[model samples]
Target: MNLVPLAAEHVSGHALLPFSVYAADGRLLLPAHAPLADVRVQAKLGRQQALFVQRADHDAWRRGLARAVDKVMQSNASLSQLAQARPDPVPPVQAPLPGEEWEHVVLALDRAVQAARRDVGWVRAVQDVQAQMRAMVCRRVDEALFYFIHTGSRRTALYSSRQALRCMLIAGEAARELGWSEERIAVLDKAALTMNVASWQLQDELVCHVGPIVDEQQRAKIDRHPAEGAWWLRHSGVTDPAWLEAVQLHHDDSLAARAPSSLTPGQEMAHLLRRVDRYSAMLSRRAGREALSATQAAQQACLGTDGKPDPTGSLMLKAVGLYPPGCFVRLASRETGIVLARGERANAPVVAALLNAEGASMAEPRLRFTTQAKHAVCTAVSPGLVHVDPPLDRMQALHVYLKSNGPAA
Candidate 1:
């Protein structure tokens, strides 16, 4: 597959031998006119008298070699320059830790639920136990999230493990804002964790196929599993009845009615569970459903089943801004940034500008804090169109900016 230079004087007018010629080392020297057996060839690069029949004239060979050499040199220069470049750092923002008392409760809940799921003997006790467990967990979850306000935006932080972590953080923030106690935060965290567990039971395929298929054959297997998942929770030795019910009822809101087994308490958890569960599901990118920007998702969430945007959803958007921290957004300022922190004011969400309109890196990020009266109220604009994979890696890069800024103005 190697090429060699040749003298124009070496070959005469068109002959019919195999047009291709290879050197003794199997390096192709020239394309020959005759077939391989009849074609004579010579290798110009190697020392041996390797014979070759002509394909291109000597002038054409020289021009090609020059072009190739030029390309290599240009590529090397660009790579070297890129290697030496220094980029500006994004600012950091602070997020409060989950309270100590609540943290222990979440740890215990996770441990108990995980252990019970593994123990077959506890299966029959599962429903009774999970129901109580989920209620306690739900209460604690309410407490943990009490500090930060809850909004309806698609504004979400991305991470696999952070699915649990972020849910706890946001929920804890919400609970604290609602005047929840430490125990309440723990309950909410547990509820969040349990809801995730229920979703996992549906297997991978169903969760992904949230497509528009109306036929019975398509819907048959889909309807039963959500209820079945609840049953599994009970059988698995989950001691808390509320947690069991939360798992069971989480899906109830999606369908027509709760199962006959569903109790009044279970019905309550089901409603709250759906909000948290669906919020989680929407935030995470799935297979068939188009992944939405945190803003877009929030918009859609605001537009409830009635097909009108929900007022609460607007509040969520306003609260989170159009883009929450860890979201990728295209700014009206003609820059593309990732939300590093939420603004204290409803309108401004802090951002770490990543790129200019020309898709070049910004020299230095312009921090936007909504709390400052001087800063114009920057609204949460639409998100940019970039597919985010391995969301956690991006979050690491984004966190620095978030930690430095206060809540949006």
Candidate 2:
């Protein structure tokens, strides 16, 4: 039977009894009668460090549950032994920001990634489909950047897809800027995803580094994951030698090397991937460090005289744009909203402000051409300023606000 674990609170109208069975050797695999009030059998089970549904559908999960029960009976555990208090209620979801479609798309893709990670078939399909999708996004980004190089447009286009997609887009943009063709782009895309596969190999403490203080040496070791990650990728049957080579040399600083030298097209693309990966890491809401602003990032980029970002900041700006769309901003009236669209005008596309800092509905969003408004100003409030994480619920609130307030006039 295929069954995935459904959250306990979600369990309803089903009459379940605590029962157990024994094995041929008369050994207890799981307790027989789990006390309904003592030890709780949560709907979740850790399958390879990732949670899997042990009772949702009617396939493997159900079979696993039955097997577990059989083990319990053989062990001679009583029903009361499995009883425990229900887990605490999950925290409320945050509302989405007004006009933040891209964030919503990215969040949805995160759910897809989680699902794919749980199912092997889905994982394979994700990799295959995302490879092609990555190429498309990369080509698009290159075109956009080429336009920027000519027109000096302040705005840029951004797409939110799986990690593979993100990597592809970043690598492709760099490749195109450097004039690499379709074949080279494929090599870069392969390297980008494989370089980070074993990211799951690191423990949470190491991944998060949630200790008292991490010394410089430890930090350096953690930073070497790309090199280690590449080794793992190569071992995993990644056939693209050029891709693996790029991955290994991505973080190395031997500008003067042997095999094609360090600054070759493939190596340069890999270097760009390294920067994008670092930028993605910082974008995540990690504890301890304050998030940086785009303007701050731009300044940081200036600090590096390498014609690229001083140390890897420019690609982020190139990827996300100087003023990223969906970015939340406060108006002159102190109203809050996210960017809704991009425009060719010197300033302004469209914005949909939903609230005031005090948590009041905006009087109404007044659409002013960012360039034509009395004072088109943007405050540099970093994402860290908000304690609550942005989510769909937040956007629903803005949707309600918009439905009530009508268009930004």
Each model's total of backbone clashes: 95, 47
* TM-score per candidate: 0.49, 0.50
- Tens digits of per-residue lDDT for model 1, 307-366: 664543443454444555655556665666655555554446655565666877755655
Q: Taking the tens digit of each residue's C-alpha lDDT, what string does model 2 give over 331-361?
A: 5656555544333431353455556658576
Which has the greatest lDDT?
Answer: 1
Candidate 1: TM-score?
Answer: 0.49
lDDT of the candidates, in the order given: 0.45, 0.45
Candidate 2 error regions (>4 Å): 1-126, 132-183, 201-224, 254-262, 305-319, 331-333, 340-350, 356-369, 375-377, 387-409
Instruction: Give per-residue lDDT, candidate 2, residue 310.
Output: 47
Cα misplacement distance, residue 107 of candidate 1 (Å): 15
- Residue 341 miss distance in model 1 (angstroms): 1.5
